[model samples]
Target: MEINILAFGIAKDIFGASKVTIQLSDAATIAELKASLEERYPKLKQLASYMVAVNNEYAESNLVITERDEVAIIPPVSGG
Candidate 1:
């Protein structure tokens, strides 16, 4: 399955784009996707913290990601 991942904040800098395309197995989980991304983009593993959001909601490691799912990379943030 082909999943389009949206990048934000520092994630955009790491990916060098606002979005990226990743190919995964049909029943791939968020954990699997994170591993795949870390392998492809080592920078991702360096982030202080990050989370994967599926369909606009924070997803757990076991959350399944489908081809139609809206996945996004959300990095840590700080505000006054």
Candidate 2:
């Protein structure tokens, strides 16, 4: 399955684009997606932390991702 991910903040820089496309198994989980992303973009692993949002809601590691789902990479945010 091909997943389209929207990047935000530092995540955009890590991916070098606001949006990216990646290939995964038909039944890939959020954990699998994170692993694949870190593998492809080593810089992502350097972040303190990040979150994955599916269909406008924060998703858990075990959540299954579908090709039709809306996914986003939310990098850590620090505000004064």
Candidate 3:
């Protein structure tokens, strides 16, 4: 299955881009995706603090993600 992954803030920096399309097994969960990404991009391992979103809202780690799902990595926020 294929999924569209969106990167935000530092997440983009870590990925060196704003978004990417990844191939994942059917019924893959958010946690599984994180693990796969970490293995592919070691830098992401350290950014584990990031939150995840499916479509337009936050998603749980256990939430199953599919090829048609829109995933986004939400990095920590900072404000003055």
Candidate 4:
């Protein structure tokens, strides 16, 4: 299955792109996708507070990600 992932704000810096395409197996969950990304990009591993959105709506990490799903990653914000 092909999942379209978007990296927003600082996430793009860590991921080195605004958007990416990831090939995943069926029944893949957000957690699984996250793990795969972290394995590929060690810099992203420390970003545990990121928010996920599936097809433009907020989604949980445990939620299933389908081939038809468009995933977006919104990393945690920091401000003073």
Per-residue error for 2 in candidate 3, Å, reads: 1.0
Please identify which of the two predictions, 1 or 3, would achieve the higher TM-score against the true structure: 1
Q: In terms of TM-score, which candidate is stronger, 3 or 4? A: 3
Per-residue accuracy of model 3 over 1-80 as CA lDDT, tens digit each: 88888998888988888998777899999998888888777887676477889988888889998877778988876768
Task: Spell out the clash pairs found in candidate 4.
Answer: none
**Minimal lDDT window, size 10, model 1:** 71-80
lDDT tens digits by residue: candidate 4, 52-74 = 89988888888998877778987
Q: What's the C-alpha lDDT at position 67 in model 1? A: 89
Ranking by TM-score: 1, 2, 3, 4
User: What's the lDDT for residue 76 in model 3?
Assistant: 77
TM-score of 2: 0.95
On the 0 to 100 scale, the lDDT of residue 16 in model 1 is: 97
Report the Cα lDDT for candidate 1. 0.94
Report residue 76 deviation for candidate 1 (angstroms).
Answer: 0.5
Give a tens-digit lDDT track for model 2, residues 1-80: 99999999999988889999999999999999999999999999899999999999999999999999999998887778
- Off-target runs (Cα >4 Å) in candidate 4 are 78-80
- Each prediction's TM-score versus the true structure: 0.95, 0.95, 0.88, 0.84
lDDT-based ranking, best first? 2, 1, 3, 4
Q: On TM-score, who's better, 2 or 4?
A: 2
Once fitted onto the true fold, the runs of candidate 1 whose alpha carbons sit more than 4 angstroms away are none
